[model samples]
Target: MTVALMWEARAVEGRGADLLAWVRQQPLADEPLRRDVLRAPQDRVLVITWWDAPYDADLPELPEPDAELVTRAVHRWRFEALPEH
Candidate 1:
C-alpha cells in the first residue's frame, strides 16, 4: 500500500533551475524513492514525484521561504500506487 505524491508549483521566470536545485538539496530525496521528482519550468514548473512505501508518502520539502520562489499557484497531489497493471 505505497503512495506517491505529485508536487506542483510555479516559479518566477528563469528561476526554475534554482527551484530545482533547491529541491535536489532536500533530505526527502535521501529516502528510498522510486524516482526523483521530475521538474521543468514552462514559465513555471509542474513537479512529478513517485515513491513507494508501506503507507502514505511524505511530501518533498520546499526551499527556504527567504528565496522568494513561492508561487500562488502551488499545489500538491497524492495517489495510491497500484499493483502492476
Candidate 2:
C-alpha cells in the first residue's frame, strides 16, 4: 500500500509568499511518488506527498520553517491508500 503525508501551515500576516518559497526550497530525504502544493485564501499552505510505504512506516518529513514565517505550529497527517474494490 502507499501512504500519503499531508503537511499544512499558515503564514504570518503578509508572509505567505515567504512561507511558500521556503517550502518550495525544501529537500526531501526520500523522493515521493508524487507531490502537490496548495494554497488557501487565509494564507494557508498545504504540501501533500505520496510515498510507496505503509501508513505506519517511518518516513522523512519536511522540517518546520522558521517560526517567524508561520503563525502557528505546523500540522501533519498520514493516510494509506485503500485497495480498489
Candidate 3:
C-alpha cells in the first residue's frame, strides 16, 4: 500500500521566502519514496511525502516550525492511495 502525508502551514506576513527555505532545509529521519514542496499565495507552504506502508503504519512527518515563523499551527493529513481508474 501507498500512503501520502501532507503538511501545510502559513507563514507570518511577508515571510514566505523564509518559510519556504526553512521547509526545504528540514530532514526526515527516514527518506520517503517521494517528496514535494510547494507554495501558494498568502505565504502558504505545502509538503507532500509518499511512503510505502500500511495506512495505519507509523510514518515520519514534518514537525512544526518555530512559533515565530508561522501565523498559526500547521495542518496535516494522511491518505491512502487508490488504484487508477
- Best model per lDDT: 3
lDDT of each: 0.60, 0.92, 0.97
lDDT of 2 at 7: 97
**In every candidate, how many clashes are there?**
0, 0, 0
- Per residue, candidate 1 scores C-alpha lDDT tens digits across 3-83 of 666666666767777777666666663454554556654645554555555555455644343337755546766778778
**Residue clash pairs of candidate 1:** none
Per-residue C-alpha lDDT of model 3 across residues 30-53, encoded as one tens digit per residue: 999999999999999999999999
Question: Can you give the TM-score per candidate against the true fold?
Answer: 0.64, 0.94, 0.98
Q: Rank the candidates by lDDT, best first.
A: 3, 2, 1
Q: Identify the candidate with maximal TM-score.
A: 3
- Report the Cα lDDT for residue 40, model 3: 98
Candidate 2 residue-wise lDDT, 1-85, digit = tens: 8999999999998898988989999999889999899999778999999999977899989898889899999999999989989
**Which residues of candidate 1, in runs, are more than 4 Å off?**
41-43, 46-51, 54-67
